[model samples]
Target: MGSTLVQRRLSSALAIMTFAVLLTGCGTWWHGDHQSVTIFTTPPDAAVVVDERVHLLAPGTVSLNRKGNHHAVATKDGYESAVMTLSRTWSWWLLGDVFGCLIVFSPFCIMHDIDEGGYYTFDDTIYITLDRKSAAWAPVK
Candidate 1:
């Protein structure tokens, strides 16, 4: 009958539309030759370690695309050294936190009062001076 043919055609059209939508919603697949790594430090002047090797750059973020297990270590004099593990998802989180903190603190840093002319009298004052060098890291040798 003509009605049967119409019903089959409609069902076919619906199935094709559903398939198209599923394919489009899947998004693009990640196919790349490298992995991403992100590093962050508290003081922003600490040394960075990559895979147990010391990178001679200042305490900041460095990205690597090499695959495999990557280790990171941050160190500065007079402060404790920090070790971090890296993965695809975790690296993204670290980058987000680092950038977020920087954005949030930028205004505060720019508007800080650096004048030391004001003096305050306190009943008890304690001051401690520490002599420490810059940060450094090296592979186990």
Candidate 2:
């Protein structure tokens, strides 16, 4: 009787462990299906413009899980807008390449800065006010 009770308890514990493992595995599988978008700009410190408006200034990366078409524009206050298109697919590819290069050449890239004193010299203090539509994120239904 005692041995039978112990066996039953062990079996129950094993079943619970198996269920936990299965649940964890399923969660991981579901997570793998999630998609994301990444944004990258040429100058690490350039402002980011979405659509035609400036969203955030300067070199940074942003991620989004939702799907839709997004236009990204990068600009520094004194510089021109560096416009780019981002779809789910394009964003991933472009960002991956950008990050990979950044990682591989970080030291070298960090040594360089946008020349602020050349013929292209524009007012470093000038801040470009981006139009509203360009900076807003609109979800496509």
Worst lDDT 10-window in candidate 2: 114-123
Stretches of candidate 2 above 4 Å error? 1-29, 32-38, 51-54, 90-141
For residue 92, model 2's alpha carbon misses the true position, in angstroms, by 12
Best by TM-score, which number? 1
Tell me how far the alpha carbon of residue 94 in candidate 1 is from the true structure, in angstroms, after superposition: 22
Q: What would the TM-scores of all predictions be?
A: 0.37, 0.33
Give the Å error, residue 12, model 2.
21
User: Please, what are the lDDT tens digits per residue for candidate 1 over residues 69-95?
Assistant: 356666677877666555332222223
lDDT (Cα) of model 1: 0.42
Cα displacement (Å) at residue 27, model 1:
10
State in Å the error of residue 48, model 1: 0.6
